[model samples]
Target: MTQYQPIAAAAAATEWWRGAVIYQIYPRSFADSNGDGIGDLPGITARLDHVASLGVDAIWLSPFFTSPMKDFGYDIADYCDVDPIFGTLTDFDRLLDRAHALGLKVIIDQVYSHTSDRHAWFQESRSSRGNAKADWYVWADPKPDGSPPSNWQSVFHGPSWTWDGRRGQYYLHNFLPSQPDLNIHNPDVQEAILDTARFWLDRGVDGFRLDAINFSMHDPSLRDNPPVAPGAGPRRRPFDYQHHYYNQSHPDIPTFLARIRRLLDSHGGRFTVAEVGGEQADREMKLFTEGFDRLNSAYGFNFLYADALSPELVRHTIDLWPGAPGEGWPSWAFSNHDAPRHVSRWAAPAERKACAALSMLLLMALRGNVFLYQGEELGLPQADVPFELLQDPEAIANWPNTHGRDGARTPIPWAADAPHAGFSPARPWLPVDPEHVPLAVDRQEEDPDSTLNLTRRLVALRRREEALRCGIIRPLDLAAPLLAFERGDGPDRLLCLFNLGRAPADWRLPEGWTVIEAVGGEATGGSVPPLAGLIARRSA
Candidate 1:
């Protein structure tokens, strides 16, 4: 067992989550301990050493609660118990204990927006109209013509409302039909969800990553959403046809968030980061984390779903949050379980290494907390899951039009020579990408200059420099292909520059600044190489 070195009490007391690097682990694809072809809590516990070595402050795990595997754990059946496939509650406790021993905070995903149809609450709600849990889920009466209650659409594809013959009405679902939306407007529902959070806190969880928080509350009147303009990008499903105004992003969400914040405040030093995405993501993200009374931070799809990485995009996104008074902190993620790996999305095959290194430097320099996905440190690209093995409901629904999320949720490559990349002794849930074999953790550990090691160095650099960790961001005026910014905190000032193009670029060095760290390419003769990133500090 490795000795634990706890962070200083003084630094953690104020705010440890600000500018923290959180590594996200998609539990189903991370590792399989029992060789049942599924990743479990014990698997994650066994892999804690690798995660702790990355210099990340915490680990944000995806849902592992009891579920029917319809949404791969997202459709949670039990809010308080661990799934049998992921191991028992004891296994979770052991995992949490091990993580805390290694100085890593544990942040679990909280899906308060909906629950599985098989959940006890939902089963009872859908059983009879006047049962104990009758109004636990969003239910509405059908129109006289017998169509859905409104024009709302599920994220999976078709109508959001499903007919429930037993209740003689329609039940709303923002996602799959099996995952019914919770009636958070009900005070009893709010109390039950808050109790779930309290349960986890009592069990020693450090924080929560609230999933699809904006979808928690919906328009009570069930008003129709207006259609979007004709040329609003490609529309694979009916969900993209509308502006999504009334279906979600209701004003009552913040009131519920305040209740959650109050509960977390009682726990002390705990954090909460809400995941808000959609057309109104920017506004809702700010609303959810605006003051000290709500969530600590919020992240949207600013970079996750972007087609390209450009200077204008970076500037525009960073400009949204200025860290002014009363404004909450921001969190950023380029790649996660839901989105395609950024290396494949942004860079060509030939320049992936350089692009990965540059992206890491850029993420570390950004003025917010950063999230790195499971295999991101290895520079892993999106896997090519075949049609036969497709498991994601959304991908299977809309075939070739939408490249589904299964490609991004493939198993992580742990060993270069082992079968299934050492993820499981048996057949894994998702196939391992052949290209990822060469970039496995075992192979990268042997090479000191590998992407995995580079990530560690970058994370350490951010931790060592106060300016990079919690400094104010000031965008520098630069031409195309070059994105430059300065992070300053009193006397500590650092200038960060990145050449996001395939050609070399040059910038006149400031009089007092000197290069402190250079990755991917050298910064010499007042020029930066292709896909290079440079960090320089001003001399006192």
Candidate 2:
């Protein structure tokens, strides 16, 4: 085992997350300590050493809350306890202790947008119209014709409103019918959510990744969403047919965020990042993180759900947040539990390795906090999950048309030779991608040129260079297939360039710049090799 020192111990206690690299761990697929074939908190604790070895500042865990697993763990049955599938609260404490001991911060997902229909609050809310919790969820009487309140559509398809016979009214569910949207507009509901945050903070969690936070508060009027503009592309599901204005991104969400921030401030050094995605994500992300009173950071689907990683796309997204006064900080992620792997999405068969390396270099060079998905360091491609074994609700509901998210949520391959790729003692929950076996961690640890090792080096470089951390990004005017930028902070300055194209491209270096680090390909003779990335600094 490699000896590790906690990086947080040496850094400023507050704002440590600024420009930090956070590794996202999907607990259910990361590791399974018990032979039950499902990952538990103890499994995560046992793997803290591997996470620490990557030199990440913190780990953002997907939800492990008590749930009925309808939308996996997103449909929370209880706010304060871990599901039996993920172990008890004691198991979570152990994971936290082990993480902090290794110098890694632990940030868990806080899904305040909705809860499992099985949740006590929802149960009580649906029991009777006059019940104490009746208003805790978004429930409304049907329109005069007994149809849904508006043209709102659920993310999983069909109407967002589900008629509940128990309450003689319709209940709102932005996702699956079983995952009812919480009425955060209700003060009592807000208080209950804040108390849940207090529970985790009191247990020593470093911060929270607010899941689908923009959906926390909906338009109280229940107005219909306007139809999308013509040529908006084919609508795969009913959810994509409208502008989604009245259904989400309500104007009052920031006020609720301020409350969450106030609660976090009381805990000291606690961080909060909101997950904001939609057609109006850029606008809402800014609103949610506009000032110190709101979230610390926000990330959208600019790159995560993108089909291509183009230079123009990179420039456009980075331009959204320039670290200006009153603008909240931004975070960037190329892949996550909910999206397809970038390696498979962006790279051709021959260029997967190069593209993976280039992606990491670009992620670190960008002017914001960065997130690395669990198996991304290993260059894992999207798994091929057949229809019969598919588990995602949205995917199953819109089969054949939607690729689904299960391909990206497969278990991490720990050993190339071990059964189930060393993710569990028995068969894993999701089948391992056969292609990922060769890219397993045990195999890559010995290969100097492997993506795993390269990722570690890039992470370390980001930590060592102040210019790459909290620096201003100045994008250079370049042609398609090539993205160039300069990051500068104080006396430190660095030039970063990437050849996003498959064929080699060349560019003359400006005066005083010399290559400091080159990987995946070369930056020799003022030329960039295919899928190459180079970082340069002014010559002394």
Candidate 3:
């Protein structure tokens, strides 16, 4: 049976994404239904209560479309159907129905940048250059010297071009060769991608999370990308050595985004957020969401996948866009499917559990919408994936140099004693970290001071504070290790302070300061001078 719902004009007028907190659940590991050792739609449906209890405005589900699971589900085999591993389209419909019933908006992933080599479109396109779908993907002839068309490099490693023996041509791939980049330059391709979005919109999806959107456009001349000066930063792949100018972030991307925006507009206020990064994240994020005619918002690697969390780093990323420059606002995520859990990444295991909760508080304290990764509220650490069990290509290719995303994608721990920690009765696709068992949902549900409770309280608090909801950020000229700022909306103001170090620091506020909110590593004490954090609202 099909369950249907419609968005009212009144609700649509307000735009659900502004200051909305989205909880991201990676289906492959969220929970397992039927004990299949793999998570599916039914598993996520069973966990809806948990997601709703967090008071999130919506849920952002990572890809679960029909695929070979090459890049998990980013490689789509079918545009409209659900992968058998996750369940059928009916199950997806039911999940959306239930999510809506709980007042949670449903936002799903749309990987428009590429398609699986096995897709029907790719199959027909690769069959012959004169075929109806010939220009659907970015295909080019080998150079006169019999080499690839350009020096662009794939994220997995080596060249971005893959030799197609059947067509005797080279195909462009920004990530995996199995995932060929689509030719957004083609009008036909644009219509086809729009149709994909229309399929979900017709099915009542509230929005889309556009994967690698900036990569949708490529240089038409097939020029070699210039190499970037080498020094060590977060990017380990040699792909980072180049500036990535010709390969991606072309001027034509904004034009394509407008087309996408128009499709989303037909649904009236549907939210679309792009995942953009590399050399031009700041510029591209701004461009991609320059106006209401483009995407609703965009998130970058500014915090997610970062190896550090210094005060200066946090201030710099926020300073890029105060939301005054662009019509589209920004979204922030500290952890997601791609990055290691912030707890394990930012703090030592001994104090990570407490520090993790504090980080969530800090994330909610920021000026933009928040994206909370599934299991993050439980303070789960990264699973230790053995070499033989690795699934991420980048993780496998780089080995010891990188901690493959496999660790973070492990099944969600739902019970302390159940088999595979209640994620599944059978063996899971990825091993549940033994350390995560203690932090299972059931275990933390009863603890009032648990990270789960802290998240619930913080999210609820954020929902109530207008100043923190859509306020402008005012940076206080504070010292390092003591991060201080204010979120103000006219007369209402919130003074936020965080001790980024292990030891406490003091700050003498200007005269007439009154404490409103107190924050700390483990407690929120409002005492003056030595008490770590202070949130003072001006007394009118």
Top TM-score prediction, candidate number: 1
RMSD of 2: 4.7
Misplaced by over 4 Å in model 1 are 1-13
Q: Write model 1 residue lDDT over 1-540, tens digit each, in one string.
A: 211122233653489898899999999999999999899999999999999999999999999999998999999999999999999999999999999999999999999999999999999999999998898999999999999999999999799999999999999999999999999999999999999999999999999999999999999999999998999767889998998988789899999999999999999999999999998999888999986799999977899999889999998888888776677778999999989999999998987888789999999999889999999999999899998999999999999887789999988899989999989889888899899999999999999999999999999999988778887788888998999988865457899999888888876677888878988767778788888888999887
Worst 10 residues of 2 by lDDT: 1-10
Where does model 3 exceed 4 Å of error? 1-13, 232-235, 508-516, 521-534
What is candidate 2's lDDT per residue for 1-540, written digit by digit as tens? 211111232342358888899999999999999888888899999988989999999999999999999989999999999999999999999899999999999999999999999999999999999999989999988999999888899999799999999988999999999999999999999999999999999999999999999888889999899998868777899988888888888888999999999999899998999998988899988999986799999977899988989999999987787666677888999999999999889988677888889999999898878999999999998999999889998899999999799999999999999999999989888899899899999999999999999999999999998778776787788997889988874346899999888777878778887878777666768777888889999888
TM-score of each predicted structure versus truth: 0.97, 0.97, 0.94
Candidate 2 Cα misplacement greater than 4 A, ranges: 1-13
Ranking by TM-score: 1, 2, 3
Report the candidate with higher TM-score, 2 versus 3: 2
Q: Model 3 over residues 1-540: C-alpha lDDT tens digits?
A: 211122233533377677789999999999888888999999999999999999999999999999998999999999899999999999999999999999999999999899999999999999988999999999999999999999999988789999998899999999998999999999999999999999999999999999999898899998899887656455577687787899899899999899989988988868999999777898888889885588888987898777767789878876776655335678999888888888887888887865676677678888777899998889888889999998899999888888779988998889999999999999999999899999999999989878898789888978888667677677777787777888865567788877777765655566566666554532234223222354677777
Global Cα lDDT for candidate 1: 0.91
The 10 consecutive residues of candidate 3 with the worst lDDT sum are 1-10
